[model samples]
Target: MNYPFEKVADGAEETKLIAEEFAEELNGGDLVLFHGNLGSGKTFFVRSVCSALGIDGVTSPTFSLVNEYHGEKKVFHIDLYRIEKADEFENIGLYDYLSDEDAVKFVEWAELFPEQLKDYDFLITIEYIDDNKRKIKIERK
Candidate 1:
């Protein structure tokens, strides 16, 4: 599907501004799926969002798989980079995070489990254009 909202982030500052604006759309029960290639600034975007939400010390959940933060609203950050199958997702108890009605979810590598996206509200795609350039597309589904 073609996303209606597209923005070019010229650098980290621009990306942070964009992320701050995007975070304004979040509320409880919101799920955001982040799609991007490695080093494409997905984590950077997440950090910006968390910061805007009043959550501090945001980091990639690569090794831990999921990270939870409490701010104006609860935020759940899930990284599925290590998950290769549905069984792995189930084993990790991701459903608990996905079903939490009081938390906003930002899922990285969520494209791995398309079938479990019934509760998702947004899809964000970040594409690398150059060393300091990125194309970010936000779509509602």
Candidate 2:
């Protein structure tokens, strides 16, 4: 539960750079859960990761709930912000994305269903300190 990999992003540029580097370490079937408040750079990090993985047009899936991308590896960007219950996630087939053996999944607003998300590759927490300052902590689970 200790986050040994922690980075302080002074601005969006640094955050993007961290995400790009983080993307390089990902392999297929990696599950990354993002924990942060709204506008705390969760989506921004996802965008950077997707871009580094050669996926284009990466956007926040707040409304759509899930976004799929095909890059060096298949990637699933899931936003659970609109999800109010665990059953909602199950009903929408979000688990289908996690079941992919050859894909990487990044989930935002993952705190909503912590019980169901105990098993994961990495858990990312982005804490917003100021307008352009964020503390990102990556913990391996």
Cα lDDT of model 2 by residue, 1-141, tens digit:
244689889999999998887898798999999999999999999999988989878999999999999989999999999998888867899888878889899999999999988889999999999999999999888
lDDT tens digits, residues 45-65, model 1? 999999999998999999999
Worst 10 residues of 2 by lDDT: 1-10
How does model 1 fare in lDDT? 0.90
Per-candidate local distance difference test: 0.90, 0.91
- Worst lDDT run of 10 residues, candidate 1, spans 1-10
Candidate 1 matches the true fold with a TM-score of 0.95
Candidate 2, superposed: residue stretches over 4 Å from native: 1-3
Assess every candidate by TM-score. Answer: 0.95, 0.95
TM-score of 2: 0.95
